[model samples]
Target: ADLPTALRLRRGAQALGGMLGPGLCGVVLAGAGLRAAMVMSLFLFGLATLAAWRVGSAQRPAETTARRGWFDEMADGLRAKWRVRLDRWWTLVGALMMMCLLPATGLLLPLRIQGLGLSAAWFGACSAAMSLGLLAGVAGLAPALIERVGRVRALAVAVQACAVAIAGIGLVRWAPGLVALFAVIGLALAVTQLVGQTHRMLAMPDDYRSRMSSAHLAIAHLAAALAPALGGALLGVATVPTGYLLLGAGFAASGLLLMAVPGLALFLRQDHEGARGWYDRHYPQAFTRS
Candidate 1:
């Protein structure tokens, strides 16, 4: 319950930043020039860094009797994550999800807009629509919707929603249609992300949380890194619409695969105590002996 709220607040802040950062840069560019805008961005980055440093300095470091090399620690994290069946399945599904979708927003969208003979301003409008949808999802819609549906079910629904939106994007050439599809994509992405985070918080033990998160991030980044090349290769051979259709099909397949994960739906549907009991019974090794 509280976890969802916390995630909402955190993601909401990020969504707002995504929406406002470009607008601020545009304002600076209009008022002064490109160089001024660049300088302003650097200044804002420095301020963010300083704030992060201050926050970190205020926290006490954890004390450990035994220290290990970074490589050894990373290996331990990977081992821990792989040992748990649920974690392993979730990580793979998350990676596939990222690979199937990241390229649509990062590379293909711009190309599709350009192919449609739309202006840069139209692209900006689509981007804003996405941000607004993201904000709406994180702030309110996701939590309420996820409460009504189990986390795993919500994730499945969100992924399918994203697939529909992506497929719609391929089929529609109108500017308004594109913008609406982008917004739906954004909302679905937010729900998927929120569910992923909430699952981690609920399922991972305290000792493994940070390590497992790092491992997940590494795998997700690797998948994301490969996504652009995959998108580019598709676009090189097929048209943009074809690329979108193929990606949407792949995404839909991933969602179907998620439904087949053993015991995941039951686990996610349980209360906190029930979930912990289920985890302990099914995956005893996931918990540290101490």
Candidate 2:
């Protein structure tokens, strides 16, 4: 479906940026001074601002039309039908996915690489491999995976895979093996996150979608913001392997909780039904196998 393609494109762009931004920053840091690096960041931010200005607000969402103030509308979204349906099962799963992996990739893995006495270049390459895997999954794997297993089941599998990969990251001493494991972890995260986002979008009604989407993004990004700090603290207290193992345990627990969600069968049926409908509309011949 077009939905899968759009999600892939969006995620691919993100992964590309994640892959490149760090290496670029490191170059600026090494070649020039910290002030030059700051200037580079400022230049990028200015370009982003220019792009946003060019985009304009011609297609603004109508969430502001609510009779109550911003806070009340935010409250409504917090209690929106889609949000209520998601419940804590999804919340924990999302939090664990973001909390465990972002930190592992962004902070722990690099430190681990450097701790092994590898060059900073190896650190950059290893970090980039995960994002590369994410891009690859978004382009080739996520769509088929979601359709084959249904979103919820796909999500469960992804989380469980991530848990193993995260732990494996701690055990590997070789750079190539570590890159492979990191790539697999990125693939799992991409599949889960892309599918998870699509599920949320499909579930939310048009009228309340914007507010609810903001709430969803807030949770995802907030965990990312916090995870680095938490992981850094954990690494301070224990070895990188132990920290990763502990984080993997959290992911495992979240996966198990998702499997135990109430009305999970109904949830899968609904998502699959929608997927089928999409296929029938977009690829009528797909129903031949229906």
What does each candidate score in C-alpha RMSD? 2.3, 6.9
Q: What residue pairs are clashing in model 1?
A: none
Q: Ten consecutive residues with minimal summed lDDT in candidate 1?
A: 56-65
Model 2 is weakest, by summed lDDT over 10 consecutive residues, at 281-290
Which candidate tops lDDT? 1
Model 1 scores a TM of: 0.91
Deviation of model 1 at 91, angstroms? 0.8
Candidate-wise lDDT, in order: 0.79, 0.72
* TM-score for each model: 0.91, 0.80
Candidate 1 residue 211 C-alpha distance from true site, Å: 0.7
lDDT of 2 by residue, 146-236 (tens): 7788777787788889899888878878878888887888788788777656655655454555666676666778888889888988978
Query: On residues 13-86, what C-alpha lDDT tens digit does candidate 1 reach at each position?
Result: 88888777767776787789999988888999999999888874325354551466777667767887788888
Query: Mind sharing the TM-score for model 2?
Result: 0.80
Best by TM-score: 1
